[model samples]
Target: MNRKLLVLPAVMGLAAPVLAGCGDSNAGSGGGDSIVIGTTDHIAVSKELPSPVDPATSYDGGTYTFFNNTFQMLLGYERSATIPSPDAAKSCEFSDTKSETYRCTLRDGLTFSNGHALTSEDVKFSIDRVIKIKSDYGPVSLLSNIQSVEAPDDKTVVFHLKASDATFPYKLATPAAAIVDSEVYPADKPLDGLQMVGSGPYKLDSWDGDKAVLSANPNYKGLVGKLNNSKVEVRFFETAADMEKALADGGIDMVNRTFTSDQIAGIQQGKEPNIKLTEASSPSVRYMFFNVDDPTVKDKAVREAIARLVDRDALTRDVTHRTATPLFGAVPTGIVGHSNAYFNTYGQPSRDKAAGALSAAGISTPVKLTFSYPTDRPATPNKEEAVALQKQLNGSGLFDVTLKGMPWKKFLPGAVKGQWAMYDLSWLPDFPDPDTYIAPFFAEGFLNLNYPGGDIKNSLLPSTRQTADRGQTDKDFLQMQDILARDLPVIPLYQDKQYVTTRDNITGAEWLLNSSSTAQFWELGRGVAG
Candidate 1:
């Protein structure tokens, strides 16, 4: 019953890699039962991604959603659920009291969509490949606890951990550990392009850059006993409005990913009579990270000064239109480890306080800085927020800020290279755990802050992971958030209020979430409206 948390924490805007040549806009034959889902969030295909949908190297939640449905994992969450249950494996459990040894037995008759026999070896290959490839943007860090993976026989696999990590099962359920066919995937590199070979609930019938069609995989032998619908079609558009138009025109049956703040406001007003609304008290969050490598921001004083001056009230109320609440910790509100570290340290936005910070460090006035955000992010007010943030920082006279808008493709690479001084990033948990939120900052250098996460990474993070009891992690998580607050490597902005809109006739829209508690593509089906 625990859930939430992610790799590419999401893809409200970023498409790291996806299927190429999805081919044709035509829907597959499912009669009145066919369902089409639309999003401003694009699904895959990028020059940046070496493997289009290789689970080991892939990071986007959108990609995870697609892959989770297509690729089998040793464990998986049931529909509308959080805790991972047996999917590829018949059952999985820690074989030791220390949580260091985990073992699993595959279901009796498992096969990849290609009918290649699925085995413990595939499970071992899927995981070992991840740690080996170690993609900079991938979820390698999530598996840092595992020392080795062993397949004693065709049916059984065991994980030998470097240390006790209670959260390891949840990590296996993520796309990072998604099982790929050893026959199809390269041992050390990603399988190139649109070719995805798996034994999950659905087969990617087709995928073009803008649309993807999925159909039930009869070969699938784990998880759901049967599918709710036989086919699913995903339409990716350039904007939320375009997605909304598709929903209104009956081109798509459901709307997920994003609808701009204004569109959501109108939808909340009950203007879209045929569309149903469901709001999730979500754990989703977004933040702006400083590239500590950047000369201007390298000094902790400048970062702290700017952090003190920037306004969150304006961002939540004016920019996001209250669709989000101010977030003060890496762990957002509604998550188990939530804290108000930033708010506790800096009471509120104040230029005088910001001036004090810089003066204390002997840094001069009006520090020149370039701030950037993804211009391509959908349904979210990222660009507007960037503009607002630029003004807020500049207005304080503590900074002279310029704005740069990077499309999602260019955005991540530039971020990895520390191209922008500071840029915006968003996260959604692949599972509901503090590790999903905090571990990456240290394990993989995914944040690329250039600040070596000394004690937080090597000590606090390991300490938190060593226990299965999430409640016991509260104090440690708080301390970690406080350290982040003091260091100002990344500034918490706001946590989201997620909304999914479905056409009046659609069923199971309320159950749709692409991230942690992942949408069971099979759970969606045609039914009489309530």
Candidate 2:
């Protein structure tokens, strides 16, 4: 799914020191009270909402905001922790040394929001439905290793895997593993539209075109603990500027997602006295994808030459204002098993090395290549970044570059159709793991709709996925990274940090930075005196 960005005009100024102030007196604070959280994420209407908001079929950041809050998984990552812990399950563990068999005991007295009993049968049904439905966009791939699911009784559920997978628990924490109400939801097909009967901390009160109202589930007793606010109103905005204005006018209490760099710089400069900023290094990364079918990039040496010429430091410092980290590998920093394979392979930006690569391939200077990027992604100024990228490659005098831009909707499909020789795109992980980074781009044909070829698809990817040991998994990934450094199917440009702005009196803002990188509404409260 394309993470949409808001495009904003360049506003130049030095950032002033931030000054923390008290919460706005006129605004309703989220201190066990109701508050509106504004975001630029497009909220689909009841009819337009993806099928059932069902975990089996729904996949996207915009939809997960609803799924994560409404549904509970058997295992979920603790706040700021990478390891998965029990949520719906009282306890869970692999029963065999091979990690092929897993057993979980459900928490007693569990009930869905609709008051239906939640048990092992429902858990079995949930996992089975995901595999049976096998929607192309669905998360069936996450459970590919799962051979069968069994429920011996009301409390005990067991999973038999075809192979050992150490990351299985982490996968259980994803929205794809959200336990559904077997009685309310069908087993054969996806349920239709915003209709949900979940067992999470909150239940859907109402959902309209502009906003979604969530009320804390009184029957809920899960691992999320107590929610500070009783009700949460999520308001959607079409533009970053509109959302910022609403935040300024006290129309909303907090703003997240798709903030322009200029807006972030403004917030950092204390431009809005009522707004406070919180920062965390995100697992999101941006990279350039090449269509191997294209004659220009088919040669591995040509790809290597281009990779050597890229200047990530300049891209982050000049365009992103140091808001992003210069990424040297597919896996972004802050995640386990991340390695700077690109940096190790191509130490620094050097024109001589790039030229040498081209020379060895019997290619001449002034290589002609066209670069494509989206015009609407405002978070990092994709267009501006593409321009900077073009300048960097052309400056080496080894290539002639042409730049093109389109809206993300068209650009994504066009890139998939092999319409662009080279295109730039960014990825926010479906789950926080190096596998999420590697598997999507390199392993399968997920992005290979147009170009049906990837270098490591057969070699390192399958080996990496099959490995059960964390230590061996890391080694396989590092080896994969080295292969990627040489093959250059995609060039990792940079990784970005997440920024959320709230009123100074808002407490628990830091807790929003969780494993999934989704906002944790339960962790936020306001009206606390500063």
Candidate 3:
């Protein structure tokens, strides 16, 4: 699976589809009133209805909210490099050492809110639906390796993978693997309403176009410990500033997702006794991927030249403001099997060396190129960062750079289709593993949207995946890095940091910033005023 991005589709003017086959329940002691949680997202929860609901498509924050309320995955992650935990399934394991076949035992009393027993048929149906409906709505490659899902009984589910993969269990833990009801969902087309049918701790209570109401599920069999609260209301807004204002006015209980480092710092430094901020390491890495299809970028010498020209230090310090660290390799730290492969081979960008490479290629004319990025997602400083990136390349004199941009909803699909010569991009880890970083873009796998020739297109990456040995995978990855360093198709930029703000009245909030960036809604409660 490709690393997750910020996924600012709502701000980018793309209307995400509403989620179906999920529900919520009531449990909080806070009466019938709801606590609003604000976010700068312009999502349309549902169409042909006046109430706001969960969007079927994956947008960063909404995914967590939707899953907490109505959906369930077989497994889940609480931190980086951690094993998947049983969610809907009572226990899960691979049947053999080959890691090709996985089996899960559902909890004995698992049932949808409607009282229908959750079965292997629903698991088979949900897994198959994602593959068949493959829409731009979300990344489908999350389930690309599965040959088929089999269920021999009502409580047992089995998955047969196309090849030997140790990480198959982690894939099943993601929201893309969310289990759905076979009865209410249509097999032919995507569902188009706000209603959901799920078996989670919380269920949907009400909707108001841009706001959602949630309550605890009384039938949930997976209650870990005593939950902190019973009700949560999530609100969507048009900008971060608006969300911040709502927080200041006590219009919301918490602020989640996509706050910059400085914004996070501000909350930490504030004198407001009621406000609290939480910080944690995110497994995600942000970097630029090159359009290797372009004639200029396709050249190994030019690609390496561009890599040598970029000032990753400046980009991280001035643009990102130390919120993120410079990425010396494709895979970031925390992800297993990651190394500083690129830095070990290429060292750092060098003007003289870059100039020499250009001369050795017999190129006297300045190379002309353009870079694109999303406008609405990261706010204004990112624009400055793009300009800095542009200046660095253009200053090399061997290159003439033009800067271009659009909203993320538009930019993402275009970048995926190899439509731009060069652009700034970021990848959030779909799962916390080195494989999450390397395989999707370089391994010639399903999400390698631009890489043709299957795995053979890049000679080195294929060698790594072809082997079943972990040591061999590491060796093959090292060789692949060498090839990429020499070719410089994409420059390793920075691994981003995730920040969250909370009121002092909030407890158990640290669990929210995990590898999946998901929090158990039941774990939250009011803390003493700071």
* Candidate 2 structure quality by residue, lDDT tens digits, 209-274: 688898888777667766777788989887889989988888888876667777888899989988
Q: Predictions ranked by lDDT, top down?
A: 1, 2, 3
Off by over 4 Å in 3: 1-35, 45-65, 78-81, 193-195, 268-273, 378-381, 444-449, 452-479, 528-530
Report the lDDT tens digits of candidate 3 across residue range 430-529: 5544566666666534232354533324455434333433333555555555555655666788877666566665665665444555555665566511
Give the winner by TM-score: 1 or 3.
1
Cα RMSD to the true fold for all candidates:
6.6, 8.2, 7.1
Q: What is the clash count for each candidate, in the order shown?
A: 14, 1, 17
Clashes of 1: 14
Please name the candidate that would achieve the greatest TM-score relative to the true structure: 1
Cα displacement (angstroms), candidate 1, residue 238, comes to 1.7
Name the 10 consecutive residues with the lowest summed lDDT in model 2.
4-13
Clashing pairs in 2: 52-193
199, model 3: CA deviation in Å?
1.5
| Candidate 2 residue runs with Cα over 4 Å from true position | 1-31, 45-52, 363-370, 375-380, 394-421, 449-473, 527-530
True-structure RMSD for candidate 2:
8.2
